[model samples]
Target chain A: MTGAVMNPAWALLAPVVLGVLALAGAALNGVFVARAEGRPALSGAARPVLEVMRLMRQRRRVTVAADRLLWRIGGMALLVIALLKTAVIPLGPWILADISVGIVWFNAMDVMVWAGMWLIGWGANSAHALAGGYRFLAQAVSYELPLMFALVTPAVAAHSLRVSEVVDAQQDLWFVVWMPVAFLVFCGSVLAFSAWGPFATAAGADIAGGILTEVSGVDRLLIMAGRYALLATGAAFAVALFLGGGSGPLLPDWLWTIVKTLVLLAGFIAVSRRLSAIRPDRLAEVAWIVVLPLALLQTLVVSIIVAVRG
Target chain B: MLSIIVFSALAIIAVASGIAVFRVDSMARATYALAVSFVAVGVMLVMFDLDYIGVITILMMVMEMAIMAIYMIMFMGMNPALMPMSMVHNNRWSAILATGIFLLLAAGALLVPWPARSGTAAPDLTVAVGEALMGSKMLVMLTVSPILFATIVAALVLANPRGRYDRWGDNLKRVCPDDPQQGGLGK
Candidate 1:
């Protein structure tokens, strides 16, 4: 909407940096989770990296009668979805794509993650993995509509589906201040879709890693890393859409972006640890009965406010 | 030149993946293959500057594929990979039918007199779609609204074999409603 406020040079590195942080943040979340569970935590911050190294060195494992091609595709797609999602986020003033319909682009990428997770589960050819896959699709179905509705409030408030325009519209007040319900529903859906924290039923430990039961070595590493990246991208998007992208006074715009993303990510990780995994059947009821109505209400209020203001 | 290259590549991808759909052994692979083909079409749509429609295409297709997989699992019974059943059937007749339809579509595309451009297209096509839906074409939405609601009702009815009255009672006094399994929320 306006001339570039951030250096174009930073655009290229932003995704790479975001990805690395996602990996690290995921590993850090593991540490937090370990400490919370009263288990011996890994020695240092390098634990996640070290774990990746171990996975790379270890021989890859495949389940009996596994569909290797689909498995590989599933494992890889998560990271790709995360990267594509981050492309729409403006780290400062410029985004990677800067498309007019950036918000929809983000939505499109997330929907791909639905297919990705299911693929990972189905490809394994194990009952656990297949069941896990089934569980996630239910979770995906449950949250996706309400999530789409939640995504719409900011777009309605700004009267633009472009991510940067949504940010620009928050000059006086962040949408989250007024649209708290949408924000909360958004946070819950992010957890649901990413299959992390409370919504991690797909990989709930009871089923011996569920969809991940048959995954091993480099594939597991990629899937795990990709999840963190997904979470990180979600946090980055939340920053742009709700927290007012790069809007802080003291720091450089990009710095604000990074800080806000990290804070939200950490908050997600912390919140996830406190909550038990939500069963799919239960989640479906809550998603349809509760969150769906609230999100629609939030959208209605935002639209009414926008019309009145105009 | 770039547009041509991009379009050709995407067209190839879409066709190949479409063929892969029938060829794939498992339902999961077919679902993904269709999704991939739809995504390629979506990207092609964006390349043509129909960004809003393109993204919506990608969104709806992914959700559809995911839902299809679930229905397959529910009705078909057992693992898709292990099953390995061919979705293709009626070989000669189906192929002939497909070829005839393709020819008809291609002929229509090549011979039909297209309408001339009316005005400069809006750069923000999302807004354009919104205005058309809310303003001039509001009746289209109104017509669809009841159908959409009916679809939801139909879906719930189809998916739920036993109604709440069956689970609870005529008086609706059952506390847990005899759930097969426990939910995350007690209700």
Candidate 2:
């Protein structure tokens, strides 16, 4: 069905699908984090993976030298900033539940990630933690450019920074098809931005667990959850931009949207599983040398195509 | 019904994950929850007739968190997932502050004077949005690409640790004498 044809059934299915995919994504992401930490996925008696949260909350440990107040604030801020970013997301037809600046708002929210991370790393009062925080700035600076280019490709094609408009633009053709190069670049940036595999050096366990090393108690919880939210948010954009929001043949619009989202998320999980963690220096290399050029080419190509087609 | 379903789904995930961001016991878990919450919110954006923004929300958050999680592991020198750590601090004040902010925002939402719908929601809001963006804000579209390209080149120049000497020999035919591998030329 075309965008002109509104299917309510699909709408219902979309959220449900998104919810399931989200849960799965979370589970998968958690599994990877567990693996990287050198814990068994599932162990006898303890269910090693499941024991993760249980162990974290069981006792609170804060480094003696860390600043208690900033440490705690940093933790809470991590989640809050993530949520703030979400406030502007356009789900389906309900724009005003809290919708504002669409994609721009989401980009603005990213600043929170830097702020919260720096605070947590600084508050931890450890050299490694500080270094991780410092490296984050470097990594952030490198990847963010490509990420932004990838993001704008869709906006350029759809003619709007507003995500809803971009999805609507897919009515005739999914942006992914029109701008295949941009879609790949965007996906790559998402993976890098999330630090899923190749670009995970900033917080490498060897370096410090970098930022969160000294954090403990409820503070750790906040930081971790914030990271998950970031992943979920990133996955949502993948679905919206490349896959086309809620588009399917038999399924309701929403359901189709959800299915697409989960499918993309599965890829995220799969990639997360297969790739080795990237060191900070290497992340910079890939982001600058590889991702950057590709993104530039993508934007240029998409613009030319749009110009020619229009 | 559609609105309710969409709003509720986005709100639940967004808020739950928002809360979870601080509620989880470890740094990694918190990051994941935050990402999920943001994804939910992005979905909501799609529902809101703001497709462009909604998709962006998802894309931006995922990359940001992945990086954050890795940094958590590397710098900490511990398996971030396995190591149990406290994630909360300033419980009483934070709770109070968060709650107070929530209430204030809620009140503003409820009390604010909302604008009336003008000209029956654009037949296709996306098209309208696209036209407005490209027609009026074309400069952003024009400028962003080049700026991004420059940034990429600058990043490359700044980040690399080695140069041609690090890879090739002085003669450009044979491998360098200081090569670490036994057969530098792959012979």
Maximum-DockQ candidate: 1
Interface RMSD of each: 1.5, 9.9
Model 1 C-alpha lDDT per residue in residues B52-119, reported as the tens digit of each score: 99999999998898888777755663553358878787899998998999999999999999999999
Task: List the candidates' TM-scores in order.
Answer: 0.89, 0.58
- Model 1 / residue B18 / CA error / Å: 1.1
Runs in model 1 lying further than 4 Å from the true structure: A1-11, A37-44, B73-81, B103-164, B172-186
Query: Model 2: residues >4 Å from true position, as ranges?
Result: A1-23, A29-56, A96-101, B1-187
Give the per-residue lDDT of model 2 (tens digit) for A207-248.
Answer: 858886776656666566566556666777777777777666
What lDDT score is found at residue A84 in candidate 1?
79
On a 0 to 1 TM-score scale, where does candidate 1 land against the true structure? Answer: 0.89
Separately for all candidates shown, the number of backbone clashes (residues 3 or more apart, or on different chains) is 0, 116
What local lDDT does model 2 show for residue B80? Answer: 43
Candidate 1 residue B91 C-alpha distance from true site, Å:
1.4
